[model samples]
Target: MPARVFVALMVTDSGALTAAELAQTLRVSPAAVSGAVRYLTRLHLVIREREPGSRRDIFRVRDEAWQDALANRDALLAQYSGSFAEGVSVVGRETPAGRRLTEAMEFFEFLRKELDGLMDRWRAHRDAPRPDGPPA
Candidate 1:
């Protein structure tokens, strides 16, 4: 697990590193690092590359990886929204069941709005310039 932590930190910085280098930095055996790398790779979170002059494999986190992951999450919410819409229709607008479904739909609708707001804030933050001096 320490190796995985090291791998995460390593990739977070420059997005690429070799297994041997990771092992040395983490003070673990090459086998251990290799195992962790293999696991991360299998999860599709990491990709492997080979240098032209070396046999060591470099592991990297795919560009826009989190974007794809979040898209998958939003897709699920959209699917649920469709199902909840059906619930609202089936229960009819005047009944208690209909009211409950409407509430559920409203809740998810609010969630979707909040997610949009969050993404807006995230983009704003990402585009904002960093401070030049030390923090207070």
Candidate 2:
């Protein structure tokens, strides 16, 4: 599965893996790795690159992978909220179903608003000087 491969790659000392390496590490077929990589690449969760002077492609997680992934969710949240708002309009705002949709819309809008602040806090925490030493 793509999630499994992502976890494996995340724990690896090297941030990148070739298709063959991923297949071997995951104990899956090369086709499985290919499919997973394709999905991950499309999601911007992983990047596909060619090794210099080699035919093999390397899949790598960017240093800001988590941040990038969270950022990408903003668009999805906006879309969902918009859909819910539309549903409220169609169902009549006074109706029970419309009330539920309004609640959902409000919740997602809150998240959309708060996500950036949360990310900013995370960045500050991540970049903060540690008494233990520099981040690994």
How many residue pairs in model 2 have overlapping backbones? 0
Candidate 1 CA-lDDT value: 0.70
For candidate 1, write residues 1-136 as lDDT tens digits: 5347435645557878777777777778888877887776655566789966988678777665555445446656777777888988887967998888788877877777788777777767766776974322
- Top TM-score hit: 2
Candidate 1 vs. truth: CA RMSD? 5.4
TM-scores vs. true structure, each candidate: 0.55, 0.94
RMSD of each: 5.4, 1.2
lDDT of 1 at 1: 55
Candidate 2: the clashing residue pairs are none
